[model samples]
Target: MSYVLGIDIGTYESKGVLVDRNGKLVAQSAVPHKLEIPHRGWAEHDAEATWWHDFKQLSKSLIHMARMNYGISADEIEAVGVSSIAPAVLPIDRDGTPLRKAILYGVDTRAEREIAALNEAIGEERVFEIGGQSLSSQAAGPKMKWIKHHEPEVYEKTYKFLCGSGYLVYKLTGQCVIDRYTAVNYAPLFDIHTLEWNDESVSHMTEADKLPALTWSTDIVGTVTRQAAEQTGLAPGTRVIAGTADAMSEAISIGAIHQGDLMMMYGSSTFFILTTDRIMKTKELWPNVHIVPGANTLTGGTATAGSLTRWFVDQCLGRDMGSGEASNWSVQQAYTYMSEQAGLSPPGSNGLITLPFFSGERTPVHDASAKGMMFGLSLNHTTADMYRSLLEGISFSIRHNLDVMQELGASVKRIVSVGGGVKNELWLQSVSDICQVRQAIPEITVGAAYGNAYICGMALGWHDNLEEIDEWVNIIRHIEPGVNDREVYERHYAIYHRLYERTKDLMKDL
Candidate 1:
């Protein structure tokens, strides 16, 4: 039987999977990593140490598992597909050595100043016309310009600018390439109409030569080299496709490729991708090209979700309870305990509401200076209330994005939910109640790694098109919205909006 390998580099971890053409997962593995926050608003990762290092580890481990557990050889793996937290800004030298730590996705708001400058220099509407999106922290062009303005020494020596997935592809295949879906986030630098890098916009940021070659998400760029093969334990000359962003892969993992298919990826952050037939230009959300050609999607994200929960554990619960064994419980066990605690709390968090902008606000608000808040806090409230409120806060943010998408005339025929968040029953049900949408949870929630494997299948012509993913994915269950909790959530959601509008200025001042 033939097999393919898929790997994804997430914010806090990386996962890899090996699968047969029938979509049976042969082997799977994961590795944990840290998301560095060096400054107040800066988030980064060492490209060589974290991304490439983790990829090699996961590859070797998964390949070994396929051989030992499933009797599959390395030669059986036909193609490799990769995805990562994307639209990141990673500068590399001519020899493909990372010059500095990679600037992460919208979670890092260090480019706020650059965003304002670009919007001022080129009118916001003009930019929207050019790029089909607004100038926000999510835009890679602003972050690229940030390096040029703040780190001129690093910028001057840069050979090519790459995203997380592109960097991994370069390490494996010695080529610098990005998918159109991922490249669309490189606003102004990439023209949505032409579907290529714009030479005109290069003047505002780095040189034109610094841009990576663009291709479709499943397009095979090259094959694994001998050096990369030795490090990764894969056979030499294995085809490597130009992988796209993780959320895109996650969306495809569950067969959310058609128009009006909304994918809510609840991982380190919560990202929403609404696939559409044509581009919908809105300042509130990002217009992205679909991995499949001649299609578009509107993307939105919160700066924090599961990461905020981690913060709560680290800050509220002490160090021993946060990282180490709390009553001899593993970290996952600790979270399960916390979830049980949260279940004890009533909905609306018993009059407590949280704004999950610990990093910043994305989507409709797009406020970099936005701060996290817990309104209606009282001495009577317990840890359960606080935890539940955090989950509710993220759900409110999801509703806010869905409202924006609906206002833009986008339809939502189906909602395919993926990521670690699906495991939390309280969180999943709360999102359903708060968002008033049913979520289709796939049986195999291994996420982007599985999606990567299928994309590899496509690259190898095992499937005719995106629709074949339906054969691979099966909906195990569905979470329908709760009618009883709607009114209470509606009232709290109002307060959630007002709380932000009222205190945003104070947050900026601080």
Candidate 2:
């Protein structure tokens, strides 16, 4: 029997899965890592260690697991697929090694100055006309401009700029290529109408040749090279497909592949991907080209989602626990206590409100200088209340983003929830109640790997049909808005929405 290997590089962790031709998972493994905050507004990743290193180890372990546990051989692996945080910028040298830390998507606000300069120079209207989205930290063109202007030395030596998926694909196949869906993120540099790199108008930051060749997500870019096989234990010449962003892969994981289907990925960040019939441009939301050639999607994401909760658990609660094993135990105990406490607390978090802009806000507000806030905290408030407030606050942001998408003429027939954060039922319920949108929770919430594996299956002759993927996914139940919590959140959401506006001036000063 043939099997496909799918791996995804996430914000805090990376996961790999081996799936049989029947869509049954044979082996799975994950590696956890940290996101580096070097400065107040900057976030980054050591692309080699966090991305490529995790990939090699994850691949090796998955191969061993498949062989010992599932009785599958390396040659039996048909094709490999990968997905990662996107719209990221990592400049590479001629040898394809990263020149410096890769600038992360949306959360990395170091490029704000670059974003403003681009807007001032090119005009926002022209950028939106070509890129389908306004220039922002999430747009790759500005980030590359930041590199060129700030680190002229690095830009001069750069051979190509690659995203996470492209980096891994190159390591495996040695072919420099990026999917069209991600290519759009480099807006103004990429013309959406033609799906090609625009050199005539926008070529100041870097030459068009420095970018990877654009390809469809499902297409096989190249086969694994001899060097990659020795390090990862995969057979030589194994086909590798051009992978797309994690959110798009997650949408496929839960069968939310049709137009009007919305995917909310509750991972390191709360991301929304809405499938559309055609491209609809808006400054508030990112209008994306779909993995499927003729389709389109509206995409948006908050800078922090699970990462906010994670910080509270690790930095705040786990502080006293010290290092090593004690720290992990402390985090677990803190989460356990908080989860129970949140369950007992009333829906509105005891009249408390929090603005979930810990890593700066994205979509709707799109404020890079936004700061987190906790209003109405009293001495009587418990740790549980604070944690619950965090969830509620994040849900408010989710609603804010969804409102923008709907206002901009995108229809949402269904919402599919994916990623690690969905495991938190309280957070799920809070998002549903606050957003007033029902969410379909799939059986396998770890959606990206399966989605990636399916793409690998496409690389081989084993999968021409996506309908087969539907069978692997089962939407167990829907999280409907609670009648009791709805009105309570409504009263709070109005204030939550205004929190940013009221604080924007002060936030910028910070």
Candidate 3:
């Protein structure tokens, strides 16, 4: 029997899945990894150690599991699909050796100075016109320029600059190519109109030739090489597709392909991708070509969601993350206790409001120096109230992005929720209640890895068209907004906005 393999490298963990040709899961594996934070605003991963090593480990484990349990051999897997936390800037030498650790997505704000320089050199309006989005920390182009200015020697020896997925594709197939949807993050260096590399505005950073070739997310780029096969226990000729960002794959996994279909991925950060028939060009939201041909998407994201919740648990609950000490409870048990405590608190948390900008804000606000704040704190408040308010704060951030998209003439007909965050019922309920929108959770929410497998099916001609995704995906549950607390939330949301506006300057100064 024929099968396919899919893997995704995420912020805190990596997951892989082995599935039959008909979308039946046969085996899966996951491994956790550390996120290196050397400086306050800098986030990084050793591309060779973290990314490539995780890929090898996950691939071998999945392959072994499939072989032992399902009687599947290495050659039986027809194709491999991959996705990763993307728009990361990883520079490599001529022989595909990583020069330095990769600078991660929008969460890493070390390129603010480069962003400002680029905006001044090439007017912001011109950049928007050429790239279909404004310069921000999310833009990989500025991060590339930052490397050139700060690490001149490494930049000089750089042969190709690749994203996370592109780096893995190279390790497997010896081909460097990035999907169009992922390339949008390289704004001003990638022309949204031409759908190709454009170095006119970013020649000071690097030339277009230094970038990977662009391809559709499902297009077959090359075959796994003998070296990779030996390392990962796969057939040498296994097909590899041009993969996309983890968020895009996560969106596709839930069959969010139609216009007005919005996918909210609650991972380390919360990402929103609203599929559209036409490009929605706005500086507040990113406009990009969708994985589906002839379609587009307006994407926005929050800098913190799951990460913020994890932080609260680690810092406030007396849970020592370094030593894995949580009194007598496991990490999962601690989270369960936290969620139950949060649920006991009222919707408004008795007048507490939190700003979830611990890693600085992304989307609409676009403030890299933004700081996390908890307002209305008094002796009357308890730990439960604080946790509840933190959840509401994250909900408010989601609502803020949705409101911005609505004001820009975008409609949200359906909201499909995915990711590890979906397991938190309190957080999901808070989001729906705050946004006043319904959310649908899919049955097989294996996330980006599942989407990668389906993309591999398309690449191998096992799936006919995009609409066939419906046969594999089904909505299992729905969360409708609660109306009783609307007024209370409305009042708190106003305070949430006003507090930020009033204290943003102080946050920057401090």
Candidate 4:
């Protein structure tokens, strides 16, 4: 049977999956990598070492598994698609070698100064008017400007600035190109209305022509390079489609295609929602290009989601619990233990609330100085109690974003949870209880990788459109808020909302 390959380069790992035309997974493989935080607010990745290496390893492994385990051949693969974290900035030389390490997604804040400078030059209102989004350290334009102004030597030799997926696409197709959703994050640099790079914004750059060509996420950018084919164990001339940001791909995978459909991605960092219909602009929320063509509206919330639980285990409990070793008590074990502990604690973690701004905050707060806090902490509380509160706090923060989206007229009827965090049933239930929204969990939790497969299927004419893609995705589980827990959560949510207000000033001092 003919199959397609979908690869996703994520913040902490890279994954690739092979799926048949019937949407059955033929093979899958993943390679984990480290994230570099050289400075408090800076997150970097050695593009060659972390992203490309993992991509090569995972892609080869997946292909190997397909051939060895699933009896699928390289020639049977019709197309390949890729997706990755959005808004990363990686400057590459003319030969496609990375000039410096890649600046990661919104989590990295080294471009704070550039963000302010851009806002000043363009005027904040004009920026919002033109790009439909506000400038953050997350925006690619500011990050590119930071490199030009701060790292003159590196910036001078740069031939093109590419994101995670763009870099992968370059390795595969020998062409540097980016999809609209990822390119739009270069706001004020990209014209959202026209879906093209802004000429005036380019004039601000020292080497403006270095940017990659823009295309739709589904557009066939080029054929696989012979080098890439050898490294990835794929056949020569395999078609490569321009893919999109991970969140957009995840949304597509879960049938979040039309207006009002919401996708809640619970990964290392949570992305709350994305909708198609436009809402009145708000300073507190992000508005960007949707992955689907002609869909102008996109909204999201960002903060510690699964990462909070990870922090608690690695930093707080790992050493003491004898789980400090790489192989001992995996993240899965820690999550399972935490979930069990959360079940022991009552809703709201017995009135102890946590602000999961460990890596700083995003969405409504947008404060880089925002530090995590555990309010009403007492000597009586255990690590389990703190962990439960942390999970709930993250959920409350998501509800806060939901409230803001509602205020801005984005209708969220249902939330489809996609990612690793969904594996924790307790956390998933708590989120549903806190948000008071029905949660649908897909049979496969591969998320963006699966979404990329769906897009590739469309590109290869296996499916008619996104709606057909949605029908192929099977829903294996659903979680609805329990009536008793809902009332208790509402009361706790009131206190959860107040915790942010009460601690806002104190966090600034930190």
Candidate 5:
């Protein structure tokens, strides 16, 4: 039986899935990783060890699992699809090897100076006109400028600048390409309307040729070469699709294809994707082309979500993260304990509130200097109240983004929740209560890895159109808002908005 394999490299863990033509998941695997903070407000990943290494291990293991348990052979795997965190900056030499550890996405705030300089040089209004969003640390192009200014040797030796998915495509098929949806995050350098890179945007310092060739997310970029086949255990000549960012893949996994479909992806960050009919731009949000041709989407996200929870658990719960695999169960136990305690806390966390900007805020505010704050902390409070307050803080942030979407004339007909956070009953239900919108949880909440597998099915012609996703998506449960708790959260939501502005300067002075 022919199979299509998909893998996604995420913030905390990497997941891979193997699926047959009928859209059934056959085998799956996961690898947990820790974020590397080499400096204050900077995040980096060893490209070869974290990204490529995880892919190699997961691909081989999934292939073996399929062969042994499902009676499927490696040769039967017909196509491969990949997705990863985007707006990443990785400079590579002529041979496509990473020159240094890759500078990660929005969470990495090392490019603040470059972002300011670019906004001043290009004019924020003109940038929004061309790219549909104002420049922020999230854009990869300015991070490119960061290297040229600081790491000149690395810049001189660089040949191509590739993000996660594009780099994977290169390793697999020797084809270097990035999908339009992901490439759009390289703002100022890429023209959203025309879908091409330009030198004029960066004052000609950036060479347009160094950027990967653009392709649609589902397009088959190339077939696997023998070298990649040997390394990955995928069959030689297997079709490899030019995939997209993990958030986009998460959007596709939940059937957020048509206009007005919104996906609330709760991973390391809280991301929202609202599909629209025409281009939409806002200083508070991001705009990009949808995976489908001619469609558009507006996106907003927070830099902290699951990552923030993990930080609290590791710091206060004594997980011994440095002790490795044996300590993982302890960390899991701590999470369960926290969730149970959080459930006991009353709505609004007994008058507690956290800003949820541990890693600076993204979307709407875009304030890098913002710091996390927790108010109403008293000796009488317990860890349970604090944990619940953090969860509510994240929910309030999501509501803020949804409100922005509404102000932009986008109405949400449905909200699909996916990612690691879906299993948290409180987080899902709290968002519903705070936002007053029901959320549907799909049967398979395997996150973006499953979405990448679905993309592979589409690329292989197993599904003529995205409507076929209906077969794979079956809502297991509906999380509805509690009417009685609405007033309490309604008041809290207003305060959540005000607390940020009141604390903005205080946070900056820190």
Candidate 6:
């Protein structure tokens, strides 16, 4: 049987999966990696140590599992595709070696100064027209400018700049190229209409030619090199496609391809929604290239979702959880325990609501100064109550993001949830109840890796198109909002919405 390998380098971990032509997962493996924060509001990853190392380890292990456990050979692996966190900026030398650490998506704030400077120079109107969205710290253009201004020595030594997926593609195929979705985020530097780098945008910067060539996500870039074959245990000459941002890949995996279908990726951060049809330009959300060619639209959300819960678990609960522990008790034991304990309290965690802006926030409120806050904390509430409130707060933030999309005339009827957060059924149900939207969970939650496999199949002619992918993408379960719970959540959501506003001024002082 022919097999396809999909590898995804996520913010918190790296995952790889082997899937057959029939879209059935045969084997899977993952390795955890750490995110480094040298300073507050700054997030960086050791591109060589964390990303490339985990990619090699996960891919090799998955290949070994397929051979030893499933009796599949390397030759049977027709193609290999990869996906990773979007908007990561990594500068590399001519041979594709990372010059320094990588600045991660939505989390890293080293570019905040640059964002302000660029916004002042190129007004929001010009940025929206050329860049397709208001400039945020998440944009690659400012991040690149940050390096140029702040670290002039490192900037001068750099030869090329690439995202996480592009870096992996370069490691595999010895070619540095970025997909349109990833490249578009580099705007004011890339023209969305022409699909090429805008010379005028980078005229002030030096060595602008260092940007990687752009390609569609599914386009074949190059074959696996000998070094990659040895490192990843794949056959030399294997095809490697130009991969996509994690959000677009997750959308593909969950069958959120058609117009109006939205994929809410609840992972390290929560990406709220994806719509196929384009809407009027708005500063609150991002409008960019869709994974599927010719499908223009909007995608936006909070920068912190599951990451908030994770912080509560690690810093607050102080529990050591193992990776891939998906058993009922193991997967959601912490959340379930906390929710049960908080249920005995009352709605709004007894007047306490967490802002969950630990990593700053995207969507609705684009304030980088926004800090996490716990409102109405008195002598009455326990730590468990605070934890539950954090979960609800994150869910409430998602609802606010969705509301913004709706207010901007985007139709969001159904949502498909995919990522690490989906492993916790209690959280999924809580989000559905709070958002008042039907949520569907896929049988497989391998996320962007599985999505990349589906894209590989389509590129190799195993499937017709994205619609066929939806037909083949299986749904294991669906979570509908309970009438009573939905009503209760609506009342609490009103309070949740107020918490952000009430605390916004104080957060700015922080």
Stretches of candidate 5 exceeding 4 Å from the true structure: 202-205, 319-328
Report lDDT (CA) for all predictions: 0.91, 0.86, 0.91, 0.81, 0.86, 0.81
lDDT string, candidate 4, 339-373, tens digits: 78778998878778888887778788777767888
Model 5 over residues 178-261: C-alpha lDDT tens digits? 899998888878888787776579563477677788899899999999999999998899999999999999988888776788
Model 4 Cα shift for residue 317 (angstroms):
3.2
Off by over 4 Å in 2: 320-334, 465-468
lDDT of 6 by residue, 1-510 (tens): 899999899888888899999888888888887778899988899988988898889888888888898788888898999999988999998767788899888777667778877777877687777767787767788888888998888888888898999999999998889998878778668776777787767764546677888888888899999988988899999999999988888888888887788899988888855665664477888888776577776878687876777667655455444222433235356666655675666555666777788877887788777788787789988886787788888888888888888887788767888998886766777777787789988887788999999989987888877888776577888998766756667777787668778877887787
Clash pairs detected, candidate 3: none
How many clashing pairs does model 5 include? 0
Model 3: number of backbone collisions: 0
Instruction: Give the clash count for model 2.
Output: 0
Once model 2 is optimally superposed onto the true structure by TM-score, how far is the C-alpha of residue 482 displaced, in angstroms? 0.7
**Candidate 1's residue-wise lDDT over 30-137, tens digit each?**
988889999999999999999999999999999999889878888989999999998799999999999999999989999998988888887788788889988777
Off by over 4 Å in 3: 318-328
TM-score of each: 0.98, 0.97, 0.98, 0.95, 0.97, 0.94
lDDT of 5 at 89: 84
| Structure candidate 4, residue pairs in collision | none
Off by over 4 Å in 1: 320-327
Ranking by TM-score: 1, 3, 5, 2, 4, 6
Model 5 / residue 170 / CA error / Å: 1.1
Model 6 weakest 10-residue run by lDDT: 320-329
Give the C-alpha miss distance for residue 63 in model 5, angstroms. Answer: 0.7
Candidate 4, position 361, lDDT = 80
- Return the top candidate by lDDT: 1
List, residue by residue over 73-98, the lDDT tens digit for candidate 3. Answer: 99999999999997899999999999
For candidate 3, the lDDT comes to 0.91
